[model samples]
Target: MTSSPAAPGSRLASRLGFSDRVFIGRAARRVADQIEAGLDLVENGLAEDLRVADSVADAASRYLYEAGGKRIRPVLALLTAQLGEGNIPAVIDIAKALEMTHLGSLYHDDVMDGADRRRGVPAAHAVWGNSVAILTGDILFSRASQLMSRYGDRAIRLQADTFERLVMGQLHETVGAQPGDDPIEFYINVLADKTGSLIAAATQGGAIFSNAPAEYVEPLRLYGEKVGVAFQLLDDVIDLSAKPEETGKVPGTDLRAGVPTMPYLLLKTETDAASAALAVQIDEGVARIADGEDPAILDQPLAELRDHVVTQKTLELARTWTRDAIDALAPLPKGTVREALTRFAESLADRSS
Candidate 1:
């Protein structure tokens, strides 16, 4: 509890490896240390879990898992477990499984997104092609399920339900919103399915596996889902970052690729002359980029869009989600878990990357 991330063999010997957008103060620091220790075990376990006998499948399956991610999902899992028995073997095991599932999902996401890179390296789909990449995802899912099976039917059901939501999210996104569907609402729901549901599973599963009060489970679930939404919404804003150095991707990349961001989606909902005018400009910018004009040609429009009121609207909406997420912790009672989670929600409200 007295050690920092740099200290050897005390607590938090390694870094948290994500944005410092969680926990606060000395009490929070103690909680963070405990979570960090659990994460160490999860990291080591994932290596063993991800190992495969097939030479080629080995490389493909380990691709993104080794590439390095924020591991926020597992972090959440371990953190909520603090509310009960702390990082028991079951909690660490489930966190590792959740992370493997998350890592696997990224392989599928890269293939589906046609992404060139992931975690600063060439995407598996780019390296080995789509079929191999998708297969890699399946391999990781199998590994995760094997890990979960040791925990009994509850864990199995959790993995199955989360995986189902992951599929439904992709299906809905691929088909596009139905006629008469509120596009904004549909998009948020899709985000929930794809992002929030898994995160919810992580948070709730933490409490459950740790033997925390049953009443705490749903609140943590709600908190996690909303926090997940807020996290992705912030990513939408980050996607528009003019500084490629920060986001490691092009500005307005989503719009150019015909993928809609909430800011751009909000453009349709706004009837104001400014929003209307900006939307028209963005439309033209997207067109030019699609027509083989330099991606840089869209930079100014993106910068303007980045500063537009709709951008503020996007940010405020993110705040609203976080506010609701924190409120979901009301049933958690006053304690380190509740306070740490509240800080976590607050931190996401301001994350730039």
Candidate 2:
């Protein structure tokens, strides 16, 4: 197995934990040189794309990128690109564009969620105000499109489709489930659209832009989408499980914001008196937080919910989706890339981030 260049138990290594990081190292070791090169290319290219003549716009656009991230999306793009010639110029450009799209969405998400911190720092909106943050997000989106444009009509179409899904997901979240809608199904679809679409694009872009086989495209897309859903589902659990120091945010941040998560949704499905009472408390807690009250007020009920049977159910379901993501890769040729993709999917489900 290939060892990570990161020092053991360092912030980067700890991000995935020792064993989980081992899985990733093993998968990508064969293509380690390419992965490292692709990562550097993405980092440099992303910074350049964020730069603009307007100093404010330039600074705003680079905010989240500068804060640093797991770089999951770009890394996935680079990994899949290995199925072809590996780290081609087009693949690097695609990776940079996709990362920009992701960073742009986070700015808008923080504003909508009223989040105070991101990546352990004040959220963009908190620092720059909502208008500036929103406009900055728009600027990144436009910049991503400009990058996509170089790859011709096909890439442009993919970008447009992914953007639409992202907007629709956010809109659906804002409007919430209609009276008769199944909340669980609706939530899953939202996860798919909001988190899954861009990941799907990243995987598909890697293969397509790298000139990998056309047949590999659909399977990779499916894999990417499922991995995205699994990733979000894991985040749902992590929202409840992680310590603030580990995640760079307080536990139950989403729950306090009245955002539906798998655990809460599962808890809602119960009819037992204890579950019913806790759900009510959860709803009340969300309302209090929405009114600008502290989330710590709900610590007792949040702890109860975190330890509930339904929360375990949510975790099990996340693992199921992660497995399905791996299954989706069955059509791909078996090699280092496929193994790495499988490891990556499993690692995502297992992560605190």
Candidate 3:
């Protein structure tokens, strides 16, 4: 199930023609391969230390490790590290740590978001229940931190800071859900803390691994931040636009949860007074769905509102962030890694999930 990295020239060419299915198919396979390498590092590295623990813990760890993810953050770290001469082992260890942290967050996030499925299967919480899921996430987080501590690399501080940002981002989203906050600002801040922080970690961790200059670190950080925002925006857009079969989740889950996302905020901004009133009604209807009311009741209004506003605006915002992300990488050296990352940024806008 492990993915392999594509050849450099092929990867670069794929980026140049990202919209082409043939090119994208190859590029995705390459990304998947690189991600699998990092996941293997995380799995084997942790197994060596934790295999003697209780069978439940061991099983939970194995289940999570096998359930595969995009491994975007680790790939970012690995590719960025390749920009400078460095010990590959150390770079990979850092990449593994980042993936561990990310998967840990996803575990907790599924619990918090009440998600039923992930990677097209039952979520950790669904398989093991909340308490075990929570504990599993804690174990992963601790293990990731422990790896950094044992490695005693200077990048440990950066990893620690990224963890703090992740927590802060979760808190920001929770608070933003309270009455009276501007939805747009809430989403922006949430994205900054939740998505941007890890991306920043990936870039900074890469720079630290390679002992890259501070000037180089700063642009990479910016690139990660912008790309992270673009990534999240696309995620929200796909949630609304993609089929549930493709995304492996119910569409409009955010709207149903009464969570204010970029699309919802844009809908609010674009609607006139009458439509705004109708929008509120739709919001209330969606909120009722969140409260366990059957979603079938909101179908008509939701469809009308979506057609009137949300979808188009979300796409437009995604494109804007993609451009911003590309610009952020302009200061970096022109190479295959940079080209691949830039192509990945553009792909965000068109992602199905």
Measured by C-alpha RMSD in angstroms, how accurate is candidate 2?
4.0
lDDT of 1 by residue, 223-263 (tens): 98998898888888888887888677887778777677898
C-alpha RMSD by candidate, in order: 3.9, 4.0, 4.7
For every model shown, what is its TM-score relative to the native structure?
0.91, 0.92, 0.84
Candidates' C-alpha lDDT: 0.83, 0.84, 0.70
- Evaluated at residue 226, the lDDT of candidate 1 is 94
Q: Give per-candidate clash totals.
A: 0, 0, 2
**Stronger candidate by TM-score (1 vs 2):** 2
Ordering by TM-score: 2, 1, 3
Per-residue lDDT of model 3, residues 107-131, tens digit only: 8998998988876568899989999
Error of 2 at 174 (Å): 1.0
Residue 141, candidate 2: C-alpha displacement in angstroms: 0.4
Which predicted model would earn the best TM-score? 2
Better of 1 and 2 by lDDT: 2
Give the range where candidate 1 is weakest over 10 consecutive residues by summed lDDT. Answer: 1-10
In candidate 3, how many Å is residue 26 off? 14
